[model samples]
Target chain A: MTTNHTNHRTNSSGPPLIQCRRLTKTYKKGDNTITPLQELDLDVPTGDFLALMGPSGSGKTTLLNLIAGIDRPSGGNLIIGGTDISTLSRSKLADWRSVNVGYVFQLYNLVPVLTAYENVELPLLLHSMSAKDRHEKVQTAMQLVGIADRHDHYPRQLSGGQEQRVAIARAIVTDPTIIVGDEPTGDLDQESAQAIMDLMVQLCEDLGKTLIIVTHDAKSAAYAKRTLHLEKGRLIEAAVLAARRAPLVPQEA
Target chain B: MRLLPFAYAVRNLGRSPSRLFLSVAGAAMVVLLILVAGGFVNGMSRALRATGGEHNVILMGAGSEESVERSEIEAGVPGVLAASVAGVRTRAGVAYVSPEVHVMLPVRVGAAARTTTQSSGEQAAAAQGSNTASMSKPKGRQVMMRGVTPTAALVHESVSLTEGRWPVSGADEVLVGRMAATVLGVAEIDVQVGKAVMIDGRPWEVVGRFSAPGTVVEAEVWLPLADLMTATKRETISCVVLTLDPYNEETGEGADFGDIAAFTKTRPDLELVPMTEREYYGKLANFFGPIKIVAWVTAGLIAVGGLFGGLNTMYAAFASRIRELGTLQSIGYRRLAIVWSMIQESTLATAAGGLIACAVGVFMLDGLAVRFSMGAFGLMIDETVIGLGLLTGLALGVVGALPPAIRCLKPTIPVALKAV
Candidate 1:
């Protein structure tokens, strides 16, 4: 069955918000050299919802991490919003990521001792906003994610779906340009997974946030405007070309 | 800049309550040891230094400069020194020259002849005046006893009759120190005023009790010089204690100790060695140097052990939270931010521990009497001691936590996230 993707209008005049040309990441594990992402090229315009799908060990998370600026590329260029993040210093890259990307995890990596409000306020603390402003922004973000009622509850006190909502609230609190998810719904049940995917879609459509999510579930991918598949360490060309021609559908092999 | 919200560091400590308690306990132990060591040295030094006046001089038998108890000078030495030294202080035309005999005399607590214990049970029994029922024979304990003339009061200003009248001269009257009853082997309530003490098989009436606060004299009993000489059958005194006129800094010529030194040199038959009381006590304090060093060494070794224990605990705690730290890093926190956060957590724990240790020290150790070779001294856990304890706790926090924090945060975000 096919799922409908949002036909959000895009500005085709400007350069894409994110661009990767021959981007690569490799590591030496004892005697074997492992390349998680190699020679990859992609363009993600602002406000685009892109789903990354692949099997285990298929470098899906690696590409997501590189795009989020959490991992540096080993070779080639990764230009995000006209800045080559690949050449930035570690500290500079961290500062760049703080304003440019917000990451959501499958397990909801909220500090266990901090309340939902505190977890959502974490990113805002990196900025120089006044306490009143931070409070306003955190409340707005939590309300938008439908977790405002549980803002005082800790992560352990909330259900899986509620915790995921808090995690999303934390992501968008900084008003970052892109929100990257590494299996954002991997741990939730089908209904909760659909709810999280729908919230992510809302974040993109309503806030103009570029959403890139790593997921293996076809239903989770169907919420995106386009779904791209990676095998081994390279993106499959046929699937990308097909996706460019139409809206998102489950294209898993 | 604010690395992480301080609340983040503070609240993170509550995540592992048991581990936090363990680390805080370790830090507290180190702080306590340092505090106790400082108190020991401070109390002992104060007890020795405060016992003597700077204007007073001591005359002991030659070659016995270390201990007045071992010195044997003729009883007429004080008279001759007072007559010869022009700067010898006199109050109301009476020279402040006190000829004293320092000796150990048997202090009888009960009639049973058994040695007394310092145990609370025995002290309680002694304090209750129940000696008649508990004793079948005389129970005696030897305490440091001083044979002093009345002028001893003028020479040693710290001593004062706290409870009853001072003993009259040439009378079979003895005065006990306020601390004498608390001394081990003599927990006797009978040592107080109006009671009779059996010394050398002779009954001496206890006419008074005295206190010399913060001085070693607080721990000694006093009796008339003639009575003690007759009772102990000794014609010699331990030392001649003399108070001199204060030096005139303006004239540069008054009450010189050089006059007493010259008098000792002329009277070769007396075999007298003279020194200022301050110098004598200074030497005595130096003699206890090894004890002070031992206290310091013990505390230092214990502190090292505590530091390692704290470090190992932080290592394990940080190991389990590597992924969390990585997540923080991925959320745009710099590595230095995480390090600062870790330091803040450790310091907060140790600071809490320091407060606990201060409470323990104040309630448990302050003013608690300890018996040393010279006499007994109460631990002085004053504000200075508490400040030192807190400083030590903070130091332990930084020294014990920073290395492990740096090591744990060394890995990159990707590598750290992959950790379990």
Candidate 2:
């Protein structure tokens, strides 16, 4: 099938919050060179809920990671807000990530030893703030995610949906510029996945958060305003703005 | 920049009970070996240092300076040295000089027989008791036997009779040091005052018990010089010990080694070499240098084994948390911070173990007797040894955990998030 692989830019009314121009990521496995992402160009507008979707071995998660500043691009520029993050040193990037990005994982990768409240408060420790300020932020994040009652419970003591809620709380606690989730609902059930997706949607609509998530589930991607499909490290298709809140099908590229 | 909470690192240790146990136990074993090695060397060195007094000199045969037991000089050298050396201390018209005979001999307490003895001694043992042979297998512990006169107390002031009185000459009586039984491989009750100890195929009464505190002479058996000379059939004495007046530089009222050396040169016919007691024992201590090296090497190798054990445990621990570590990094915690947290966890476990080892050293290993050719000395588990033990344990934790922590944190966030 002939498909259009486009270098996407913002279609929103305002300037984009993230700009990726000719982004490339390559690594060596034994003797062969593997490029998980190659010359990928994308723009995410502010207050946008974007979802990245693709098959296994596609670069959806790779793109999410690159935007989150946890991984660097081998070629091209990644400018988030204003600074070119790809040029920043590793430690500097970490400082930027603390202030700018919050990442949620598929399995709700909360430290097993810490309580739900401590897990939510983890990122805030990187910032210099009074105990009262950190406590208030953590309380607000947990209450917003509706997991304030389970703050004292550890990961093992909580159910899967509750753990995911705590993870979402942790993601939003820092009030970062961008929140990235790599298969955030991949390990949850249908009801829990729907609840998590609803919470994420509220984060964008009410809090004006810019969220980029990588998911393989069509139902999960339906919550986002737009969804981009990647194939072999390239963008093959992108859904329209404010895509229907149902199982999404790709629009004609 | 930002660090994980101390509570976080501490709580991580309780995740796997078996791994924690392995880490703590391995650290304890390594630390214990280090403490033992340190104590042994410290005790040996202290014993040698205490055996020599700087103000005393030993005049032995010129060629036999290496060992007092091998040295032989004319019996009249003590009287001549006392008169010729102006620096020899004297009080009440008697010089602080002692002509002595030194020998290594077997000591049989009660019915027990010494392992190193002639066939006649064995026959004597057979006549004493049928169980003598069984008791004789001390493995092999021999003691230094020193022959001394009444004037010996004047120069060797550190020796003091703790129980009973000095041995009466010509009566086959002997004065035993407090540690004599330990060096003779016998029960303490067997060598108490009024008991009999067979030496040189004759029964000698243990009339007195003496102690020289930390010195090596505390392990010797002292008898009358005349009796020892007649029993060994020796025509010459082993050496003459002279206590010189303490050298005072400001007043020039005391004498130094040069004064003693001049006296030796005036009469080369005696073929005597003058050595400070400190130098003599220092040479003996140097003779055991290789043994100390072997001790440290063995400790180091075992410490390596403990390190590997620690590495294996930590690797397994961090392996299970690979995804969690990735999550932390994604939370904007730097790699160095994560590594630091891991080291904190490891050091806590090892530090606990180090404390246990140090406690054991203080309460049990301290002052434990160790036998050597010179005599027996107690293992000195002093502050320095304990300090070294604690430091080594900390180093073990830091060095052992670094590789595993770095390896676990190697996977990129995308790859790590996918780890099952």
Interface RMSD of 2: 0.8
Specify the poorest-scoring 10-residue window by lDDT in model 2 chain B: B111-120
- Per-candidate local distance difference test: 0.84, 0.87
lDDT of candidate 1 over B293-335, digit per residue (tens): 9999999999999999999988887888888888888889998
Model 2: lDDT of residue A143: 94
TM-score of 1: 0.89
Name the regions of candidate 2 deviating beyond 4 angstroms.
Answer: A1-7, A238-253, B114-140, B247-253
What proportion of the real contacts between chains A and B does each prediction keep? Answer: 0.63, 0.88
Top-scoring candidate (TM-score):
2
Instruction: Kindly list the per-residue Cα lDDT of model 2 for residues B176-267, writing each as its tens digit.
Output: 98888778777889899998887776689999999888788989999999999988899899999899997788877667888888878888
- Give the lowest summed-lDDT range of ten residues in model 1 chain A: A1-10
